[model samples]
Target: MSKLVFQSVAVNTDPMTQPTPTPALSAPDLTEIQTGRLADPFSLLGPSHRGHAGHLVVHLPDAQRVTAVIDGTAYPLAAQAPGVFAGMIPPGSAYILRVGNGSPENGAQEWEQEDPYRFGPVLGELDEYLIGEGTHQRLWHVLGARVIRHEGVEGTCFALWAPSAQAVAVVGDFNQWDARRAPMRPRGTTGVWELFIPGVAEGASYKYRIIGPDGRELPLKADPIGFGSEHPPQTASVVRSITGYGWRDAAWLEGRAEAQDRRAPMSVYEVHLGSWRKRGDRPLSYVEAATELVDYAVDMGFTHIELMPISEHPFAGSWGYQPVGLYAPTVRHGPPHEFRDLVDAAHARGLGIILDWVPGHFPSDAHGLAQFDGTALYEHADPREGFHPDWNTCIYNFGRREVVNYLTSNALYWLEEYHIDGLRVDAVASMLYRDYSRKAGEWVPNIHGGRENLEAIALLQRVNTLTYGAVPGSMMIAEESTSFPGVSRPVDAGGLGFGFKWNMGWMNDTLRYMEHAPIHRRHHHHLMTFGIDYAFSENFILPISHDEVVHGKGAMIAKMPGDAWEKFANLRAYYGYMWGHPGKKLLFMGCEFAQAHEWNHDAELDWAALSRPENAGIQRLVRDLNTLYRGTPALHARDCEAEGFAWLDGGATDISVFAWARFGGPGDDPVVVIANMTPVERPGWRCAFPQAGHWDEVLNTDAAIYGGGNRGNMGGVVTEAVAHHGHAQSAQITLPPLSTVMFRYRGAE
Candidate 1:
């Protein structure tokens, strides 16, 4: 008997549509298909035709019987090779493959399923063209696993951009984790491999098995654009659909611009979700945080809740800074939809949510983007430009157009998909310069022979431009520490186009000044006033972030150089100074309540510390500070403008005291802030006022409620008819030891 085989047929969509006379399958083809090394499984497998005969092939490993059922008639398929079955049937007959596995130990078990290879390519010409040009603004649309109906069959369409790979296949537990079961078709010249697999739907765990350009099989790689990942320690890309999340934040989204306006008061409470609170030994899930964390932020008078990073990461220690799945919110908390719930929960409570986005570098995990196609596909090939020595991670190859497309779209995805109010890009300083934290010769200079990373700068600008342009009212902030010019300016205006920049200089100088003992504080007086010199250079956020209170830095209370009583007072005073300063504010978790110890990512915050009167006082002071900062327009309206501030006395270095005035627009009330840095009470000390009138003490760090000495100006004081420090009105006030007092001017007496 002559065994009939056919030549590989090219079916644009479905192989069953075309009936043509063809030669038989070669021995080499059978061998290739058996070993999972076949270039095009579509040609060797699935249903094809030769005149009136429809030939079908399926690799049903260990199957005792393989049958093709066409409109109720059964046609048995014979084995051409080990588990490789092929036979003839009526040409153009639509059929499903049925395989039977019978064993002595177990009863006969049979399953019937549609052949995946019978379906055609899901990608169209437009997708191929845009992908080939590396200009796919919606790159995620065509790449990665997407559940869709293809050729009238509901299944998942798998696509990947591995131009350098010799072969690629989709592998999952459904196929017994065998790559040989499903090889993908390469679209011409686009460098994209695609396959539409019937019965492979959402919730399936999958990864790509690639034969690299060197013909060596690389480690299984997780989907670069996967929307979900297996909880770490067992890495696999889960087929979780990111669509159909009906957002309840439309109202909030509409008014986000006004809420995030630079002039608007923005008091952010930054938190690391894993360590913020815990149920037992585990962190609160995103669903639980939706209630607890959101309510807490609102109760604390915060306008926004800034999460450190919810992006899926391999190591919890990295705190999501080294995210492997940027699209997937970490399963450590909850799934993607639950994270969306967290965002919506915040908006429902009138609190905006900001994500600490990390685009500067990615960790080199085996299943991650590292050596994706047996090449440095997502990072630079040269270690000098590719590797981050400081963090021991991989710096992105921003020069590649595809890489740029990937990152830029990722930013937009978070904003559009999750309803995130803003993204505070982390470690931006590292991306701005090529020589960051590197010895001179260890880094590569840009084309201009400068230390600046021009490519990275362009990528940052594009991401900002794209995200803002796509998602209305989306803020792009930079965690930039350098003196880079125009960091918060628009890209067209020769800047990185960030909405705001973290005032790292202010944080450093102020913390250093506060760390010094009171007697020696006179020498560091300039540090306290130095920030005003460039306060308005960029729209700034005065961030006392988590970085300050970790890794031997000690808690905020520990940083104060004094005895227990003075420590609480110093912290309360510093909080006052921070609130009175001219900038948006961000306080790390635990810092608000004066956590007695350094932050540990492994444990929840020292919530028990608030039981102490002094600790509770710090918490009370923060709540009052936020209340005052928000309620008083004079303190915040011109926060980013120079005209809003006036130094009444910056040269009171000998007394370690400072006084400043904050103003709003014309006819608005003016607020005066006076700080007494020393422990000695200076009674009858006169301070300047903008107008001669009765001034009400709005907030005093030394008030009894805040565990203070109760030495303020008896609720309200009338200015005396005396000139002082370039002001028309002067007030004889008692300066409480290590205290800060805020006074709002009332109408003229």
Candidate 2:
């Protein structure tokens, strides 16, 4: 007997018959591969050992015939089962799979491509270790579909974290959406599935088809870290390049690091880009908004434009609050690069752009992160810990390190990737409390049995710290309504580490007080003066945001309890008062012109309202107020300092009149602000002045041009060396009816 070997198949050259060895893949493995539930598809499929020869296995249900093409030789693969093809071949480093055409069973078009499983894992050992530990700060750089060149072949690499899944596969147009064709290889212990398919290019739509650990097939899921997604109603994630954007705001960025000081004047114009101004009911593109919104904000003297949430959201009604794709900017406006253009355009016009970020809860859409991997991987498993009653959404499990990293990276993504100047974190109060909107026994308490959500607190602190440290000049503002202490303090100082907090209390109080009839306002005068008691407690932004004008609350102008002319006067007076108040300012889009109707997300603002003089006057008043607030040191220099403000006549409730003085640094000019909330004009109202000098009436809400009766001091009044309101100097001037006035001392007359 002589031993012999074949080139592609090893065999003994004995003349006596000996049965050939069985195939490498058994019947059970073939069944698993055909059903697409094989936990270890890599073990049976792809290249494997068969006796002394190498075997190639491929599962293509649509293919009529398949051949393993190694070098120039084509080896036919026998159909072991429907969609399951296998054959023995010579050992080789590379091979391609050719399918269709040449089979007698079914005649189909022929297509040849590199086998996806032939490539090794895209992520390295460090990536696996960090991801498993949930501390991969730049998870977006790894998990999402990234275009890379592997083995000198350029293609997109798809990776997903589905630890509990029995199997995962990359299904896209390239593979004709066949799950079995591109089965991914599971990395060791990371629960991450990755496959690098050569020749897949940018703009290719893709998703993961995961088989649950229970052996049940699941709905295909969109990529959690998708860089871009199709427009709403289309859930597939699109492969997009995150780089190659040319920024022209270097000067703005450099100056912003030093110029965005707490003491500096910041007047933000909050806008919903979708409803701001649509072209015949269609929303403006990012480029259009860049030119229109940027120029308008600049002309109006606003320092920043706080855009309502722009993250990728499924429902338009949620207004980006129930965002599904945290890493992707919504495609409603335009592509990601166009959004970047909007930010760059804003900076070019010397205006900062602030994004309203929502990280509190996510919608439980079927295609979203809910029940991802058939497990509570991103959220809490218990409803008491994960569900948000108020929002009817799922709260992120901030206690999970991976969830925290996901959110923290999202914050930095907007700031560093898009050059966003700041983020107005939305619904932070809900995130801060475990029993936010739940009744007794309906919520779970922290380890200390308190209402505080310690994990969410820690997450906020870490995100804030990371944001401010990583992105210079980036601001993190909290829309937290509760009295959570030190919200705007540094993280190391045991605070939530926000740059500013929205003054919801002040907004509510002032709005309520303004709603009362002028005569009745005298009794509630405390509402006007009470905010100052704790004005310096936290850095604040006085926001007349969209929330106040929507949901049947009526517009800001409608909140005024007066006739047409009186209403205009009252609103102008309020505008002046707010600009003169001790805090940064934010005004919603239509509030500047006193929009008649409440804000509707479906419609554009009432730009026609400005055609009326009263509305135009309000707009002009707001613009002037912004100018005055930005230019005057006394008004904004120490807006967050207690020593900057003093009450000159806050006790005059019976007369519906209040007066105050704002002081600046030594030698800087001082300003006097007085408001007569009543409809009665006082001819000779005396208020304490900072010095004995000529006090120039810099801004009068009752000026005729501002749709007022022109009842004010003539140009200015000379301060008299008379004791009044606890000051050595006093000025007696005409107080406009239902109006606010501001004066600055010029020099000794």
Candidate 3:
């Protein structure tokens, strides 16, 4: 037997009494009714409430007959409208209804009326599915910080932060597109909408029907505060309740609740859901992907899984950065509940989840940010601040208080509501620099007239401050490519206060060296040693991101200048050196197995590449790199600390080599590392370790698993005498031709 939680079940008159309001009810009550399959939570089936009177209505869009078995009493109906019928059931009767076309008709549209609500009756036609307990309390349960609501002349006023729209209106399950029937009045100074629908309360689904100058009616959208939803590109609707979902991870939450700082080394595996896999052709359900990805990352030694934007967007290739619905998770891939299930499942596996949130810009979809609330509800009035000239997208107005609350609140919502571990703010450089894509005359400076965009910075600071305060374990990250100093510093210390910043400079410098130099001749000595100087500016993660491989840029493997075998070997060497270098690491999707072609968002990663031994070897190298990094104290030892790493030597390019040390703690072994970048292999390349005696080869770039020639001194072997400062002391040794060798000191006994 299925579980049912209904406060009170009531029924009214049948369809025969619908044309006129009957003084006496002829329909039977609960004793005469029978129940069919209970609709899923948010199911369009089951009886939907019609206004506040508790009248129930069901729609049969295509039906020659409408038969409802109420307590074993059956009622029949004829098509009164297009594939539709009128219906009024006896109050308090349990119902089992079947509506279908007795004779097949050629695509006729069907609808039903005679009630206050017009809800579609098919459960499977839309994106969301019914789950556990369905209740009014669960409806619109999620609260976002930014919804600007005020008491108005007749009712409460609500507004958003969409500055691009010329006009906006409030439309939903209510009003039926009557412009003046429930027009949202604009708040004079704020460009927000004011309305007072006294009857409208929680669970009353509504959307902003914005009108652009083109005279088109935008589709009704879901309120970001919706407790349960299918999300979008599907139309937003009111969900009654969800029951039976069991949530675990109490122990993890207990530890994370006190302070977010404890959750450090937030290694995130960024993923695009659709492109992550192929389910024969279509994308896998969130449950399927989440289960597999969590297992993969946890086994691979990553702490967190940061999903590329999962917000609702229409385009297939956008990677979820161009969001259409501010609050809704995309319905294109799967239902919202399924997404929640995925997060919950991940939590059960003890893995943290982060979402790549794009609140800085929105797409130009008429149904979304454009003309919302009869104006630019989600953006700014000033064209200079309202547009992203480079991306052809609408820029958000950071100065707006409501806007600030909306975005920051979204950060909090994902963490609190869905148990997301953190957020990686995308395109932060565009948000931080006013003149980023503008010419001298094309931009307006902030009040301070400084290079930094003050408003945007202020918004980011607030977002970080509030989000961190709200959830202590939640991390805030910035994808700021510009040289924004102190971006990851504390807010009280005059910085943006992000937990970490993507080290774009490091990625560029390293990739440039690998692409241009033969092992023998590298021009920029600073390329290898550059990060040490700036590593203290902010906590950084070196990322070989998607931007490196798309839009005609060849694959990372293809970028190496040599024969295919040599190129693979060269690539392995470069990665090995990078792993030993300062800062944590991130590689884009296809880089792991040396994907041959550029990344295509519509297609899956080149899985076929695994068949080739070279490609498989590269993958093995990446796995080893991650494993060794995690196992050793030196690699991530100094992350976010003042005395984490130091370079002993900085000069020389040809046969260039350098030594560095990373300290995890006072008594711990300061991991010593050395690198050689010469085009040809040097048989006995010599370097001296800072410490003396029996230094072991902990990690080698020349290993076969990493696509190298397996030509290197193996680990656990003692280093013999090496010449240093005209003295022979057993010290660290360096290999040749783009190689990095790691060593540990023998105890100081």
Candidate 4:
């Protein structure tokens, strides 16, 4: 390689047309640019000047001849060193690089392209300040690969935060995956590296090649704020524009903002999209699921559909719990816009969509946030504080301002970008406590030396406040299993600030009571009554979630200890009992029809089982239960209030029978529920009634339509003015074997 020097030569009177002296380039500059280790590639390459004329320098690794093309006129460039070319041109705003195969005689190959390093910084100072302060609530807009127009040229702008990295570059197919050609320019003190490549359009796949602070090359990392990604098994982030989606759910959104009251009926169908239903061996696309899932939910009378996590993950077995891409929806079904379409279609059909969001911990995949920039940037440095024992994953460093901002903004992203109705925050118990699932000496205490994770608490509170304040009528629900106080209360009032909490105690006790044989049920009758002790402690949702049926726990139907026929009857009775209980209801996908097999994330539900009368009957019973729950004010109007429920006879353990009365508001008649746990029928059982004229049997779980023995009151019974069970009116009714019976009070004749 030979060194080349240019002398100053005055030509024309016009400064723009005059030839000027060229700036000298050292050996270090050429080596740094060629080796892809330059922190600021723009300083040494692209358009520059020593005096009046413009100097264009480029590092084309394999080219023999290079030219600076200005207005279609090609100016031959002299070789400063091997693969390095420099030349002077008349000062101009725009130019392109033209190259030819090795020596002109060899005639290798040639191409012309716009220079990426010619553009100025794409982000403003405000973005840098906000991101540095960790208050950039709209960080996604600045950090991701976005298709943008710059300097009258159209292309994509890629930015990433890798403060600990010595250098970073954008590598993609456009550059033959070479990191040297697209080295990013680091903004001052912000730790952000950015580059705008002209002509790089949407759908281009890219990844960041980062050089760690120690001058060692790290594995290529996916864009943490990428809007889209290549389907799994391929980890490259794809440049996708999230705009231009036309939403047609204005009426639904308007009504939701005004009418999402706590007292209204909310029967949710929790569905794992991958396993809900499959087309042959493949899961349905978001568009297909939008129609199929929405219609099914509407017909079943469910108020909302709660989906398991849809964030991008490497392993399907995690069921989206161990997410990698917090911003990009998993491409398993479709792109980000299709997810918006699904949400819009659901709202148009009068069905609300709640996403199951996982923010507690993340999997320890190499390509993920683990050891990002060769440091514990997203997690704690201490193993006790950062590692999750149960999952073998990494706990987020909530104490870090940037990490907190990342998570909090992600919560808002779903609500604002995708129009999600609610967020069912998963594993909130794990986030609330520092010693979760850990024994003594296995965890570190907080600043106050208590189990509470103060940082996580503050993060949760801030996210909840932001969600409720920004998105009208959006819900923030917690799946917390601990006895943490006031989870659903306002943050100012000393609470975690959740809209509702999963009633895990109720689910556990009720399932335990239901698992007992008829002869042994009386001994454990308190289990069924225990939930009411703290039922109104918080706004609750009685969720029989997917967790109950997976692992070795067996299906809900199989959990009952009985003969096949008895099992079906017991499940039906339980369903009626749960619906009548005071709280909103949530049933997992297959549980509505009592799927015989435990839920398998890999396989679809047993839809063929519905052909069996027992299973079909369970389906019918659930549909009617939802209809009754929604239509009857006494059953749903005051679900979260104590005034709605009154125990009629919770102590009838000898015959294993329980009765309760659910009331609406004042002047509204009450509905009485009687559940017989034993197979033996109780005849002429007198139950209490608030009013005196007559009582109508509204639902009978043992009706022959539900695959139970046809046993119930004829139709209606007139109540006599006799005091019984602490009520002024009493009625003699026969309770069916292993059944639940509900009756509505009629006015005086």
Question: For model 2, how does the per-residue alpha-carbon lDDT over 180-256 read when each residue is reduced to its tens digit?
Answer: 77778788998888878788887888888988878777888889888888888998888877878999999999999
Q: How big is the RMSD of model 2?
A: 5.0
After superposition of all CA atoms, the RMSD between model 3 and the true structure is 10.4
Clashing pairs in 4: none
**Higher-TM-score candidate among 1 and 3?**
1
* Residue 564 shift from truth in candidate 1, angstroms: 0.3
lDDT for each of the candidates? Answer: 0.87, 0.86, 0.61, 0.87
Q: Report backbone clashes per prediction.
A: 5, 0, 49, 0
Residue pairs with clashing backbones, model 2? none
Q: List runs of model 3 lying over 4 Å from the truth.
A: 1-207, 210-245, 255-266, 716-736, 746-749
Q: How good is model 3 by TM-score?
A: 0.74
For candidate 3, write residues 228-253 as lDDT tens digits: 33444455534322223566767777
Ranking by lDDT: 4, 1, 2, 3
